[model samples]
Structure formats: structure tokens, C-alpha cells
Target: MEPLEEIDIFIFDTLTDILFDKVPGYKEVVDMGENSFFSDRSTYLFMNEFAVYLGGQIIADRTSSFVESSFD
Candidate 1:
């Protein structure tokens, strides 16, 4: 397994925050290895979802800036 990059850590941390908000005591479960919530498959899915969401946000921001600049 490769080491996590800064972005990977950020995304996982964001997901952890989201999980913690939705599920009480989720952080405790995640810390426990036996029945970890951040399993391989779950991590993969969360990473993919974060990437897509981030990408779209970036594109939208860039587009809005471009349009604003063009009008200025």
C-alpha cells in the first residue's frame, strides 16, 4: 500500500467529519481496527466521491471567474 498524500489525508478527514456528524460515536468505531468503518472499499468510494465533488467545484469556480473577467 502506498503512503497517503496530503490531499488524501484531507479527503479522509473530511469524510470522517461527515461521518461523525451523521453517526454518533463514529470516530470511536473508526479508531477500532476490528470493525473499522474506513475499510478498503469504503475508503476507495469516499476518495472517488470527494475527487468528483472537488473537481466539479473547481470547474464551476473557474467558469464563474472566467465569465466575470470577460464582462469586466
Candidate 2:
């Protein structure tokens, strides 16, 4: 078997994340929410979009206190 570079692990890990509907980031870190995580995106936008849909809820599931209390 060939070796995998450190950064290239995303190529494999991202697919696993989609298949399992999990992200290591969310599992290991608390308060880890992403509104726009495209900075580290794939070459095509559709690919990234699809990944997000099946990769579980990393956004829109969290609510801020101001939004909930209606005070800012």
C-alpha cells in the first residue's frame, strides 16, 4: 500500500465523514460550529456542497443567546 501525505488525508477522511455522517472536528472539539467552511474546500463547489449535506449538521443547528432571547 502507498503512503498518504498529511494534508491529503482530507481526501480520504472527508469521504469517510460523509459516509458516516460524522466529522472528527465536531466529535473532538466543543462548540465547534461552522457557518462557512469553504476556506478549505475542494476544487468544485458542488463537491463541497454535497459533502456538507451528507456530512452531518455543522451549521444552522446552533442558536445564539441573543437570537433566542431576542436581545442584541
lDDT by residue (tens digit), candidate 1, 1-72: 456566666776786676555543334444655343356535576545444544554577845542333233
* TM accuracy, model 2: 0.22
Lowest-sum lDDT 10-residue window in model 2: 63-72
Residue 29 of model 1: what lDDT? 40
Which candidate ranks first by lDDT, i.e. highest?
Answer: 1
- How do the predictions measure up, each by TM-score? 0.38, 0.22
Candidate 2 residue spans exceeding 4 A from truth: 1-4, 22-72
Model 1 weakest 10-residue run by lDDT = 63-72
Quote model 1's TM-score: 0.38
Q: How many clashing pairs does model 2 include? A: 0
